[model samples]
Target: MELIERIRLHAARSPDSTALEWPGGTIGYAGLAAEIERLAAELRGRGISTLAISLGNGPAWAMLDLAALHAGLCLVPLPPFFSEGQMRHALKLSGAQALVTDQAVVLRERLDLPEPMGSWRVAGRPLSWIDLPGDPQAVPAGVRKLTFTSGTTGEPKGVMLGWNHMEPVVRSLADAAGVTPSDRHLVLTPLSVLLENIAGIYTALWSGATAIVPGCPEVGLIGSSRLDTAAMTLALDRFRATSAIFSPQTLQGLVEAIESGLPRPAAFRFGAVGGAPVPPRLLERAAALELPVYEGYGLSECASVVCLNTPGHNRPGSTGRPLPHVRLRIAADGEVLIAGPGFTGYLGEEPPAGEWWASGDIGRLDPDGFLHLEGRRRNVFITTFGRNLAPEWVEGELTLEPAIAQAALFGEGRPWNTAVVVPAPGADATAVAAAIARSNLNLPDYAQVSRWIAAEGPFTPANGQLTGTGRVRRAAVQGHYQQQIERLYQ
Candidate 1:
């Protein structure tokens, strides 16, 4: 319970249903529980406590994130692709005493923040308020959602969590994706991360459904690693979206716009891809274009789904099985641990020293329990003839070759493996060297690659080489291709 008592139990059992949708209106569930108890009573009459929500995906950023969990305050969520020194190191390491933005003169001329300590109009937009001088700190008594960590491979830590560790992972992801109220979901990413704010608006308002939220250019999300796919397939056919959530590069541009003919949304049912590592030939070309997608797995220290692949229980390359309140294990050097009830520690660090949660991700599980993963134990590497590999398993088999739109790999001690690629758009260089010789004939021979080059661009998140949840910030793409990876190792 308590996602503000499940939005006042869906405003006492569906008060006029709808519960949020955007491009200018639709609020219901008793006007989203009276605009989250009137902006959590105008943020507990301005004493605020910790707030921070930098706004973007509409409906007043889901009514001030459930009115900062109904005004017990503490929120944080900034991430509009961070970087103004990670939003002034997350408003001075989360000491944030009040921010609630909507750009506000580009965060008051880039983080000088201060001025207006008042302004609001809630769901009809506007917003403002600054305050922020500091001296708040002390957050760790069931800290209610601090978030942060999408810094790809650098600074962005925070984590925290609470609401009894994120309402049992949003009631085990609405009972492993069977979420109903006829699931209209569709806020494809950025409700300030935490996997689209607890698996896309707390599992679409814990199954009373209808989330939608718009803006990120009405779902084509232009910035952090571009995406348009015909304005995200006309915002999933103008919100006929029956469930959404993606990031395996926007489910590889909506499975290459449903293999070029574009037109998947016949009330789309369940999408859910994950933040990274999803290439079983892009889930076999999104199941040969039937495009139901699936593929899940998480981290934000487990509060955002801890394994999923739903819809008649999927498994096309694992990362499913484990959501019934999560518990998965594996260690014995294969890492991926995770013991249940959603993790609850990490703002200034210290708290997780055991009872599983090691998850520096490297996976296994199987024997019908699914899971799989296999990468990021500090991204493996080690070659100089000793072998070892796992550059996301050779860049997920060189992006399952639709003329490889990205690949990174590099051999940590050298002796064979190179890559940089990027292609896919009139591809060439003989179709990216024949898709790296058909991805080195299915890798091995010390994780193959041998030599490659092509990428003088496209590894995005505005060029820090990806990671506003698109992953590959591999030391900023090996320091922006250190002289074409030292001329492919001379």
Candidate 2:
């Protein structure tokens, strides 16, 4: 539960062993822990007992985050891609005055940042004076990190993750995923998502595995300096990476790596996917390609994972069974409800106006006892043809390939589904569409994507298409492609 203690233990046990990796590079436990202590001392002189981090996936970002904990400052990760509009909203909402960010443009263009300390820039320029001082100390028992629930109606609600909330969940996953001290596991998702924090960081480091952060922007998200196929392959090769956690989107990159003749490390042993429902087709291709991908499910409230399919216990379409300590129930309406370690709902919000948490997701368990997630209650749509549909069902099937990076299917009052997709960087539109067509062969006519369009670019969070948790804003997606949808139908 003590942040500094965990790092100290890792540092003492294997001072020379690599503890974590980022796009800018790797850090040995001794060095990282030392830096945390040094950074803590620097922060202490500034009289700041709290920190708000606004960086992305890399060594610097992770260092700032973990160092803040060791420094005993209440930590808050400012989702790096929030628009000025959203940033101001979050700032006002959280009352965070000090921030550490990687955005040069925001500083140069906006002209509104706290007083500059020394000199700083993201991509280049200068940010608010960058001199701060603090000493690393054990965080007291209370709120540690404030993670937000992506907006449902309007302003996002902040969820306070008490210091101990993630320790158990991270440990459970490390146990379930078979993480070991010698392994080097790639950290893929953005920091805003709990998956990367719990499964990617805590679990990997807890098991004494080297948590590798890609040094490039492409390896993790659209523009991440720490991630890319080549970087991932090189890191896996260079570090002898043993495992990873990915979303379906991230797995698509793995498919590309295979196709590009990027060698999959024989040491690579485990991988699991979630964030959204993963199609069976995607799993099949991942398996065939030797990526060892397994599908799973979780939410931010659960601190990342509750149920996951592991190597030998794999189920293709299901999210798989819950971890031993998690209990699950399917409400009469078919929504999945869970009670387990690691979960605490939004801090300021009342639990649905009363007691038990009602996940807005609708799902059911098969008679065979495996869990099957249906669509989100807010997302199910009835078509113009009077056919009710789960858009994610069709969209998930389309994203099974190495080409489709993102997809959205909507046609609430239309005869059939209309999909708007973003293809992988260089994939041809016609070819990608054909692949989707081929994948849809088994779906009923009503459920099939009757028309589809591909965009040349992927959506960015700044444009408001993605949430901090990396979920698509379906309405924003639909609105962005409105004219294109009309063109497809006509």
Candidate 3:
């Protein structure tokens, strides 16, 4: 069944059941369905063929997204973490005719947008609607969602997907996570993220589960890199969240908070960690704290989730088995291959000719069928001595140290590796050096960092050194610290 149809069915079957919850309010299934219907009708009446939205995690964002999906208007979700240039590129690439955003001030200042075309209020939050001046660009047929990829270059690529691509993933996630009306899923990340949008929100709606979607600030998310785990834990406890998702960075913060004596929320039943490789040590720490986090793997091309670890079957170091809907294989060269129904191709790009999509990720299925990822195929670097290593492999080990927060390894055809290290808060230079020594003990001499320099600050999207999803932009990072890195080599 279509997600919207399932939502309507839930409304018909259980009108009074809560479907969405926020800081100051709660909406029942019937109320949510009615609101989506009303907004969808208004959008259709306005002759809107394409819609874009930039809002925080809240009922307003949720309703706008559902309404666009129900009205069959193509939806473009502009991520808040995107720079103005990337945002403009997405708007132009998708040819969004209208944009509704809560952060109108940012848009006005950044994009030089004209006066608002009108105002809209949904679920008690007021929003501004701006009519953009672009014709609808041609996209592949059945493209309903235009999601931008966090490309290494400054410009992000637009990934086009249809309902057929999204719904199966939603159902797979719902079944994998065992989502039910009793599960109060917490929105820990931005709603614009495909992971959170499809796996978190859409899956929650499909299963008739209540979603607690507070603004980013309420969930302790600040900008792209900073997280207040204490505040996040409080929110989880306050909402009694039964499920949520996190990037590895956020999960690290939560684990540290628990170790610092913050009471762990006992209501959590399912917590998924993804977007980048989860350091196995971090998972071990979380498990030691009784935190129920499952490691998963996916890409935007797969419509968010391809494989996920669940309570029923999980491996701490491996991304769980592939979901029932998708087939996974390891090529002879070790690239992960995915064959699924949902991928429509990129905007203004040719459709994939092959039955399988090369994920660009190198991985292998263990004897138990769990997927174990190494790193990006193109990111593998060879040392001057002919030793090949993936930076992520070394970086992951470095970050396992409590004193080191982020590490970017760079050593292509160089005698030794050098890293730009961002120290954890309150960690001193001596402490960081000691942590590096400890990390180096775990790595081979070829991949070990021989010298390192302190970074100016934590890599972030604003600084163009980190992707919105929290993965470091390696090329950008290396370029930004070129002189310092050269000094280390000398």
Candidate 4:
């Protein structure tokens, strides 16, 4: 069933069941369905074809998203973490006709809009609605959602998805994770992230579960990468969240918090970890703490999650089997490929060429059919000896040690790999070296980090060294540390 259909069914079956929960209020299934209908009618009356939202995560965000879907308007979700340039690029590229945001004052100054077109209370939160000068750029007829990606470099690209591409993933995910009406899914990452929006919120709603969507600040998410584990855990406990999605970095912080005497949310289960390659050691630690994390793999072009590890079938280091909606295969060159109708293509661009979308990731299916990812196909570097290496594989091992917070290995056409290491807070050289030595134990001599330099600080979006979704921007990091790396080689 479609998302809106599922909401209507839930409202009819269990009108009083909580469908959405936030800091100040809760909306039951009946209220949620009714509210979405009203909002959809309002958007239709205003003649909105494309709607963009920059609101913080909460009931308002949820309601507006559903309203856009119901009203047949293309929804463009702009992540607040995006820079002004990126935000402007998305708004223009997607040809957004209307914008709904809580930070109206700041966005007005940055986006250079005149006074607000109007203001209204949506889902109990006061918000501003502005009319944008729609761009003439064609976004394609079938596109229903345009999600801009915080890719490795350059301006963010808008990946468009239609209802057909998204619904299967939602239903498959709900089935894979075994979501039910009793489950409460906490929205940990930004809803603009397709993974959290489709796989997290949409899946929960499809399963008739309540979605707990506190603002990023309420969950202690300072930006794209920095998180306060204590605050996040408190929210989990407060809402009694049964499920949530996380990137590897956030999961590591939560594990450290639990180790530092903060009680783990006992109700927490089905933690889906992705957005980057997860260190096996980190997964082991989380498992040791009984955190119930499952690693998955996806790309925005594939409609968020292509494959996921579920409770019934999971492998620790592998990214798991493909979900039912799509078929996955390894190309002759070892690139992962997904077969389906694919996306509606990037905004203002021609439709994607092939029937199979090249994932750019290199991985293989195990004997038992589990997909084990090595790293990005383009990211693989060749050493002077002509041996190929995937830096993410080595970096994953390095981050396994608690002393090392982030690692970027460089050895392209060089004799040996050199890592720019970001040590955890208060970790001295000795601690970092020890961590590297321990990680080297798990790698072959050819792939070991023969020499390393301490980074000034963690690789983050602010520094242009990390993507919004936590993937390391290898080129940016190498450029920043070129001189130091050369010194180590000399």
- Tell how far residue 389 is off in model 1, in angstroms: 16
Using TM-score as the measure, the top candidate is 3
Candidate 2 ranges with C-alpha deviation above 4 Å: 22-27, 102-105, 119-141, 150-153, 218-228, 341-348, 351-355, 367-369, 384-386, 401-405, 423-433, 453-457, 468-470, 483-490
Model 4, 1-490: lDDT tens digits are: 5688999999999999999988889999999999999999998999868889999888899899998898888999998778788888888888888889998999999879768877889977899988888863457776788999888878888999999999988988989999999999999988988999998888998888999999898987987667898998788878899999989888888888888999889898789999999989889998999888999999899899988898899899999899988998899999998997578888767778877888999999999889999899989999999999999989989987889989999999999999999998889999999999999999999999999999998898767788878999999999999999999888
Tens digit per residue, CA lDDT, model 2, 178-279? 887888887766776667876887777677778877533545345521236666555556666678777666676677677688887678888888887777
Give, for candidate 1, the lowest lDDT window spanning 10 residues. 133-142
Listed in order, each prediction's TM-score against the native is 0.35, 0.85, 0.98, 0.97
Error of 1 at 377 (Å): 23
RMSD to the true structure for each prediction, in A, is 20.2, 4.4, 1.2, 1.5
Scored by lDDT, model 2 comes in at 0.69
Between prediction 2 and prediction 3, which has the larger TM-score?
A: 3
| Model 3: residue 73 alpha-carbon error in angstroms | 0.9
C-alpha lDDT of all candidate models, in order: 0.81, 0.69, 0.89, 0.89
For each predicted model, how many residue pairs clash, with residues at least 3 apart or on different chains? 1, 34, 0, 0
- Per-residue accuracy of model 1 over 239-346 as CA lDDT, tens digit each: 899878887777878877768887888888788887888878778888888778788888888777788878788878887988777788787989888887756676
